[model samples]
Target: MDGKNALCRKCQDRLWDTRIPASSCERCKSYVEAGGVCRFCKNGGMEHIVSTYAPFMYTGAARTLVMQLKFRDMDDGLAYLTDAMADALPVRDFDLIVPVPLHARRERPRGCNQAQLLAQGVGVRICVPVGNALMRFRATSPQSTLASLRARRSNVENAFALCGDADISGKKILLVDDVRTSGSTARACAKVLLQGGAREVHLLCACVVWHYKGNEKNGSVAGKNGAAAGQHGR
Candidate 1:
């Protein structure tokens, strides 16, 4: 428990007075380990997206790390994202890498977009950030609260729009994101990219929440149970 490294979001107390992997919550006695999704967010189709090449699950030390990365501005944590991105979906020759942008309200407070930070970590030549490339058209209830998959999809339907500057008619796009709870967000963005003129839009993320049937056979999700990616492919 490193106090400087491990700070409880709930209590704001430093763990072990030094930075170290957090084991348990000092206040609630709950475990704060990595590679696990919020047990609170579990039961509702919130399993480890896919063990294979998924974004680091939010459990144990991994969870704590992402928390610090996303909310606490541990900008350096982004380095970890680089390997994950390359391993999750290797981009051999993508014309551009576009990170899904957060709403202005959310981005203003955080002063940054986690997905964009991740894209930077990917170590590829950066094109325009295109923050306005996909506008969050309307605010909706947090996805965590939506228990039904249908509801989740609807919550994001028509919630995104493409930028006027984008020209994808023959370009290949690699869209990046921090996490993928449901394919809804990525799908929405991909639709817009395709309509905007993108010849191919590949969705890449730190993690993919739930992989479907075809994912395994196509190098998408190796094996049914899911494991870290072995070889990166489109």
Candidate 2:
């Protein structure tokens, strides 16, 4: 298999075959495949937190494509991501489609937003890609570090702001990002959208850290190291 297919296969295998339970919530179950809200959140009865849908887990073939797309600036790598995002997320009839924005300093050098590229791919299926709906307030340290969840949340707090008069009042908004880590960035961005008068914020990504909680499938196996396995931004 080629690079992209190989990456996807790895993801497929983990989600399907070697699925593991989330460490926290024992009631919630997740596999590497796709679909459904996080079982952990559901079992915990957390209302604020919603299920994050991802087509692939953050490992294997998915990791390779993400890395190349961000580092090598490989258009083909991006092509794979876009197609998957579109297949995974169909944002049709939504009041608006918003992509998480990058800081201007970072964006200038990259010349493109990975989230926007994903949005464009999804838009081909739904016909709506809002590129300038939101903006990052400032640059912050990567979430991989920050020691604790609280620190991660603080790292992204007030990190995003609405740009222009894109009225989303009582309108459904789709928030797109390349990946979902601790969900801190997504939460922070959702706060901005809620404050901007959006009726609701739905989260979508190409991949997310597999936090399966405690389902039988999740506990059955171990997850491979996804660190240094993928890249984000630019």
Candidate 3:
């Protein structure tokens, strides 16, 4: 395979080519159907997040990369993914980069937390400190296994707590994750960070589900909101 870094040139092209459209929700970056509603905004919780940024839509080669990193432990693509994520960041003043914590049970079996790996890559590229500030104290069903948004939220509600020795008072934090589906997990973590006295919480993910159907066609041209093959929203 002709490649630079871990991804082949073809795969890299396909990965960076999938960009979300400007028609996405201004708050959450979920695609807004023509004259249709954005489920992300409709469900609320945008207030808890300052903005969300992602390098690719969770589809095609992008999905494959995330899956390989998380499930297969093929982290070679971490450099490319985090480089894109760092470029996609809307602001540069973050005091810390914190990965969403995986419960001990899950992390032990998985052997690694994909989110933390991404966080470390992003922190290195952006020159920000990375911290394991949040702990997933409760083990909940995987959000992907849940059907409804309510159920997803319920599953993760109160699942995260701030690490006892972490001092986040008045500091802006960037939360890192592999993929953002319903966003229930991210919001849960952000809520804990905010309550724990973080001044602001922003999100940076490798990819975001462009639409609920997960079948949105890829666009050749980057959208107005697309921040270098990535999308960001306030």
| Top candidate, metric lDDT | 3
Q: Predictions ranked by TM-score, top down? A: 3, 2, 1
Badly placed stretches (over 4 Å) of model 3 are 1-5, 33-39, 212-234
Range of the 10 consecutive residues with the lowest summed lDDT in candidate 1? 225-234
Query: In candidate 1, what are the lDDT values of residues 103-164, reduced to their tens digit?
Result: 78767887787778777666353332333356676776666555445666677777778877
Top of the candidates by TM-score: 3
In the range 1-234, model 3's lDDT, one tens digit per residue, is 112466777787898677656666655666776634455465564558878888777777887677778767565687778888888776778999999999999899778998999899888878999999999999887665555556767788999999999889999999998877667788888999999999999988888865543323221212322332232111
- TM-score for each of the candidates: 0.62, 0.73, 0.84
- Candidate 2 per-residue lDDT over residues 1-234, each given as its tens digit: 122463455455543432233332221223323445445354332223344445665666666566556556666566656655555553356677788888887778778878887776666666764656688978988665454445666787888888886677787777788776556677788778788888887776776655432422222122233343223311
Candidates' C-alpha lDDT: 0.50, 0.59, 0.74
Better of 2 and 3 by lDDT: 3
Q: Which segments of candidate 2 are over 4 A away from where they belong?
A: 1-51, 212-234
Better of 2 and 3 by TM-score: 3
